[model samples]
Target: MIEIVARNGSPEAMLCPAFICDACRKQVMEAGNVIYAVRYPDQSERETSPLFVAHKGACDMAVQQWLAANYPVADGWSDLWDEIDDFLAYLGGNFKRSFAEDADGQYVPHVVVMPATSPKLP
Candidate 1:
């Protein structure tokens, strides 16, 4: 997945522009409704991967649940697997990651603001 983070800290919500939601297929009208941007890498020969725009609460919950269910504990850390919730929370609260699709249909990086001329549709 493509995850971009701010160099200094989390991105200011108000400064982010609205985009079409990759999860719900709706317009993400405000910053308050954004969950996070998740870029799924191509598993085959495709040049670009799909970027998904998650809704705030619902998408966060879904990601957490998926992490909990699918992520296995590492070799030496028994407690690490149980900390997925905290990890996800930290990413959401401490970073500036967003979704951006490229010409190859991959969600690339935009560490701060969305690119001025980036395509809006996913």
Candidate 2:
């Protein structure tokens, strides 16, 4: 997975590997758990490793998502694992972006905002 550092909650590339993998896993302090996609430029498409499971109630949902990607549905989602509900609260709270395809077969969701803090900003 490609790790990005958010600028005021927006995504940015990780400067170095010094940061812990846990660092890559952002905590949704207020939002609960951020659910954003992260695309690894070099890594081939694959599901999240089962071994990385945590917060089973929440982690279970993560596992389900990883499984869905491994087995895709062209029409739409076939199965909504119970774990999914556990993660939805944080879907927009915190996110990681990537160019890799999700179950929908696209490079994750993203869009520009109206500039929060800027000098006559873009």
* Candidate 2 ranges with C-alpha deviation above 4 Å: 6-55, 63-66, 69-122
**Residue 80 miss distance in model 2 (angstroms):** 18
Each model's TM-score? 0.25, 0.19
1-122: candidate 1 lDDT, tens digit per residue: 22332233455433333444444455543332222222223333222112334446665455434332332234111111213344447668647743452344664433322222322322
Report the C-alpha lDDT of model 2 over 8-121, residue by residue, as the tens digit. 433654443211122225332322222232222234542222112123344436544653464335523243322223554444443663336345555533332221221110
- The whole-model lDDT of each prediction reads 0.36, 0.33
* Model 1 regions lying over 4 Å from their true place: 1-18, 32-52, 64-122
Q: Model 1 clash pairs?
A: 49-106
| lDDT minimum window of 10 residues, candidate 2 | 113-122
**Clash list (residue pairs), candidate 2:** 34-94, 36-95, 36-96, 37-96, 39-98
- Model 2, position 81, has a per-residue lDDT of 28
